[model samples]
Target chain A: MSASGRRRSQKYHQSTPYLFIAPFFLLFIPFGAGSVLLALGMSFVDWPLGQSPELVGLDKFATVLEDPLFGRAMRNTLYMLVGFLLALLPLCLLVAVLLKQLRRRTANVVQVVIFAPITMSLIAVALVFDLLYNERVGFVNGILDMIGVGPVPFLSDSDLAPWSIIALRIWRVLGYYAIILFAGLQAIPDEFYEAAELDGAGAWQRFRHVTFPLLKPVTMFVLVASSIAAWELFAEVDVLTDGGPARSTLTAVMYIFGASFEQFDLGKGAAASVVLAFAIIVSTVVAHRLLRSDDRA
Target chain B: MPKGSFAGRMGRGTVIGLIVIVTAFPLYWLLISSLKPSTRLGEVSLIPSSVTLGNYVAAFDTQIPRWMLNTFGIALLTTLLGVVVAALAGFGFARYRFRGRSLLFGVVLASLAIPEYALVLPQFTIMRQFGLLNTWAAVILPLAANALVLFLLRQYFSQLPEELFDAARLDGSGEFRLFWTIAVPLVRPGLGAAGLLLFLNAWNAYLLPLVMLTNSEQFTMPIGLAFLHSQLNFGIVEKSPWGAITAGTVISIVPLILCLLVMQRQFIGSLTAGAVKA
Candidate 1:
């Protein structure tokens, strides 16, 4: 083919691909990138609803930094993240490993049952949890009564309310995360286990040496995803507690929502969002880099 | 092979059984609570001695149906728009070699890390500017460009054998037509997986709608339920209708549960596969 002919063919090829891709960029540019920049700009000013936004230049950031409630929300978010990691991650891995050992049909049935909650609206889950945690007539309190324990303030007391929210979150997410890890577990070739068996390795040894290392990528992915999810914990708070009993469960996202809608403080809300976004970005990047380093090592 | 001891099998069975019970009990409680009579709900029992359809009836008579319709419409629209948009972008990245393709693709991947909450404020402002607040369009438009869906579809499309494109070209099929007829059908499973996920996410979305839609009538299931709960004076001496709340909760889950039952395999596959790729 001559140079001009080749160039003409390449141009035709490029045009086809560009046509195929134009819709996504066209939509995303307006919604995703545009919104992000708008939010970034909105963060710098004192913008209230129905009022002209005054350019304050980092005043909102300064306020957020000084606010006790903002500090508490940050603490609550971190606590929820840690609680989920501590409780759900290991349990999910264990369940996934156990499911991998079961008969395929039984596993599938169990998986469907466990994963049922993942599809249900968070509102429904929250309502159900609210009923379950009711101080007087809740099933949880009823069970405690049977065991001679007093009615626990699941959603009433500030200290216990956040845990109640965390409990609901853990329940909803464990099965989903387990399924993810289960897939990772399945992807490990059986031959690896077989080889380990020939070496007289016990089940624990096989899991510790073979399963854990191989599942690192999936684990890291879940960790990062769940951490980010934990940061945005709002539905349960919105429905069950509404950041009640002293704003104990007021997550950063919930705080942003309340600020924007409840107080109509768009500027401060935007600033809070920017700060939250920065925290998420920095932590995720740091976590990713650490995981990559570990992988290399 | 050495046979494991009976004790070993029993122990494993007991542990698995316990885990299943713990995982399933809350959902089972919701079902039972929904069916129990409103007056007798406080009489604690694992099995309801008397069942009544009154709670469900009351729920149906209330705003449950409206909430379901709104939620379903929003979810369906988002799924359709998201899939179509993602397919185009995915096909583009998979099939075309262009300058800055890698760089653009990286931006898409980076978007996966951007928290949805971070975008809520700006999205709300944009919706307000367009006067789309309290409308379904507010819910549907912004979510149509999901980065995860785009990335998943692109990865799946790129894995197709190059010979298929050559075969289509020989048949004089244009690139767009080839993608529509050949590539799409071949990647139906991937599309199903992505579509199902997008639908589920949209259906269950609470935070975005809570922020975007202020009108009570326009609220989705999540928001509607929250409104109901907020209105319920739990602290008042008057008897709170636990039965009705449970019934409403159960009603909210029925569609999702039915969907999961019908497409359990596809749903699970999508979730697991999406996670693996991430």
Candidate 2:
């Protein structure tokens, strides 16, 4: 209770908070920051596993640019990215809107059922899709036969393979985004909708103005998050198609994995990963800016 | 929802029904195929013609049980350590206004944008240097400091009443005591939610383990099943691997489904809560 005791105690409080937070820095500095720096350093050198390192300068980046596989992988990744966003964004939002119309119990059960995929193994998902995409003796082909449509090569055809992969992703993530957006929807005060109605706003008009903007932050978060995952599209590609059917499902991360581990070309893999990192950072930053621009308007 | 319109209600029901089928059918198909006789796995019947545990028996021939143990070990360790560390820092950042607080927090938050693919190459090299390659630590350490976990915990800690802390302080309770006794118990729900999310993320982790764990003995469930699926597709073995793949897939997902069903509220809460605004 003395003044000097109080002074010492206040000093203790100031410094002990640092101790409380020390554990994060201890792990993060080495595992997070240091590794990132080392990765950037490794990108310029030819550091194959079990081989003497040699500085390669920009050659790795140039090699990535010149590689035909890289081109195909990039194209495939972009195609999936575009197709996924085109479907996922509006579809999740629409699902959220429709969810509002359901009885509470039905909606909750439906939510749990659809959200089940997020918990399932991506490999399981890949195998399941592989079964469905089988050209012969598959459920899909059987259905097509009944409908008078020829058996479609969902995974075997390059043109359809990427889209098929996209469909699987959409199916996997639709519930996740829908639930997040629905939570965001719950945050929008009913007063706003009532005010919109009083102002003669129809459902479409209210959604176009009020719902969309209020949902913007969550939407942007999902966009960047999903886009990041899309860029790192390795597991499905690895399991389902193995970047096959002429590399139609080949992805940036798959290419990186093949180069680094399979071939032991660590430098090339690091370089490609660095390039992808920059793309993710740039896109995410742009997304943040887009969110800000909304505030500005 | 068009009020009092039977057609509109039917239309919504139809659409939702279709969506449910599209999403749920894959899981259903997996379970059914996993239970079917290997000879009948190729058949188009939605339900199995003959239910058998033969596929599961075959799948056990692979290293699935061992892989599951490894994955479970990794996820459990990651959750235990990650939650404790995140909780300490979460309490620190929540209660204290120390020097460079915002700067440190912002730096941590900024690291979220660095995708795992970008970090894996360097992380692999780091693991190699530490001689952690082919070990579970390679996966656990990097994944432990999740930005969302810290963010979720910090946000939850901030919501704790300052009066509780001050009251404890007035009673001469030390900071750690207050943190352990008051802050932690209050934010237990947040911690539980964050831990479950982290465990699932770690369990479902694929790329890092695939790259680091070269030895078949050390493979996690995802990578193991992936290897199994590849073997089935390539048919390198004499017998078909479909029965095993389906069975392995089914086994791989059971834990996740159990966890999700048990912690449905927390799983949904942690994910949707954080993503809603940030």
Candidate 3:
């Protein structure tokens, strides 16, 4: 009411926003931003656990670059990433499209069932898969035996190991990503389909000309999101394979984890982490560019 | 054929049925394998010939109860702290025009790029520095600063009508009061969604807990299972731990699966909301 009171309240309002927002920054600055910066600093030094870190600028990075295990990890990660995306993207789109045609209640129930795996502990899921993938006395091999196929070494044997891990990853996330694309499909009104039909377009044509184009944004989202997760592959491989049966399933994060925790080579771990981060960023950008370039044409 | 045709419907139905089976079978297997007798674990069967609670009884003999307690306690604390922090920040970013608003919000959004993998080493070092290693606080602290929760809540709060806040202001309500009485209650769905996501993420988290807590006594459910599993594989114990591993898997997942079932809409809806928007 009074001029001084009004001005004081105005001043208080400005600080109010900061008060509301300060908690996130309080946590973010020290934990979120600080740790990231600290990782960069840690990468430059020879920091073993429980000892003083010494500055050895770029040497850790060089060692990381030359480490054949690191190279193997990246290559395996890329191999799986491509396999994951190639398999996941189209499967998600197919599921979303089919799910779109189902009655609403039926669609929702199916979506929940499919999305259930993502909610479970990855370790628990890995254990279940490990049992399922076991060589002898395992369910998978039992079924193969029934069908006259030889017992497959899903977790053993270098060739089958990565694909086994990749299959596990796909099983967990297929429904989750599909549901997102399902929602994207839902947002595209029925009129789009009706109009396409009225124009004498067939089902495949309708999907190609209308559904596919409109769904690109969500597909791109799934592409980038799943690829990033794929690039940082760790827990499933670690628990199920330990990046093994000869390091066939070894991944970038597994490499980083081994460096930092197993060997206590924190500097090398941090450097590898930086390198992994760079790969994630570049691949993400390239994915965006790849998708975006197609948008115009 | 058009989707409306009978043949088309049959094909779609078959595919959907197969998808449901593939998705649901592992969970079903986890359940049945847990129920099988310990001696029969090596015997694969689509049906459990003899159901027994022996494995679950055996699971309790392990550190599972403590691990479950550790995981639920840590996840609950993370969800509580995470929701409150995100709500306040969401209200700020949505409701007020402050200096450094976009810049600060940009900083929050940018943190999502720093995945747990990248930050684990530094966070470990920092936790060790604070003398908090092998404690619940070590896991809860970093996870509580969740960028995704903030982003979700910010989107929720931003959609609220401005007139509600303006009316509260006219009643001489303080800024915090307006947020508490008006904006907070209005965003209950957002809160539920954010809380569920945070809880689920924390409960199922592996890497952070794996790195921070070294003591087996401090192990969360995932780490504990992994420990048992690795032990089983390496023959660290003479007798098999398969019985315990299968039973523990069931126990670890049941709570979150119940959560998912109860809040199925929010679980699916809010996640899709975040995915589409992000």
TM-score of each prediction: 0.95, 0.95, 0.97
Task: Please report, as a residue range, the 10-residue window in candidate 2 chain A with the lowest summed lDDT.
Answer: A2-11
Which predicted model would earn the best lDDT?
A: 3
Q: Write the per-residue lDDT of candidate 1 for residues B1-278, one digit (tens) a residue.
A: 11368787677668778878977888888888888877666557988899889888888877778877898899999999999989988988998888889988888787776788888888888888889999999999888889899989998999999788877666667788888998999999889888987898898888889888888778898888888787776544344546557887787788878877888887788867876775
**Chain A vs. true chain A, TM-score per candidate?**
0.92, 0.92, 0.95
Q: DockQ for each of the predicted structures, in order? A: 0.63, 0.66, 0.68
Question: Which tens-of-lDDT digit does each residue in A156-220 have in candidate 2?
Answer: 89888889899888888899989988888888998998899999998899998899999887888
Q: List residue ranges in candidate 1 displaced over 4 A.
A: A1-14, A289-297, B1-3, B234-241
Question: Tens-digit lDDT track for model 1 on A38-122?
Answer: 8899999999887888899999999888989999999988887888778888888988887887788888898998898787777
The TM-score of predicted model 1 comes to 0.95
User: Ten consecutive residues with minimal summed lDDT in candidate 1 chain B?
Assistant: B234-243
lDDT tens digits by residue: candidate 3, A163-274: 8888999999999999999888888988988899999999899999999889888888899899999998899888888888788999999999988888989999999999
Give the worst 10-residue stretch by lDDT in candidate 3 chain B.
B230-239
B162-272 per-residue lDDT for model 2 (tens digits): 888877777778889999998888888888888877888898898888878989999998888888777765555449788888888888888778766776766677767
Q: Each model's C-alpha lDDT?
A: 0.83, 0.84, 0.88
Which is the better candidate, 1 or 3, if ranked by lDDT?
A: 3
List of chain B TM-scores, one per candidate: 0.94, 0.95, 0.95
Best by DockQ: 3
- Could you give the candidate ranking by DockQ, starting with the highest? 3, 2, 1
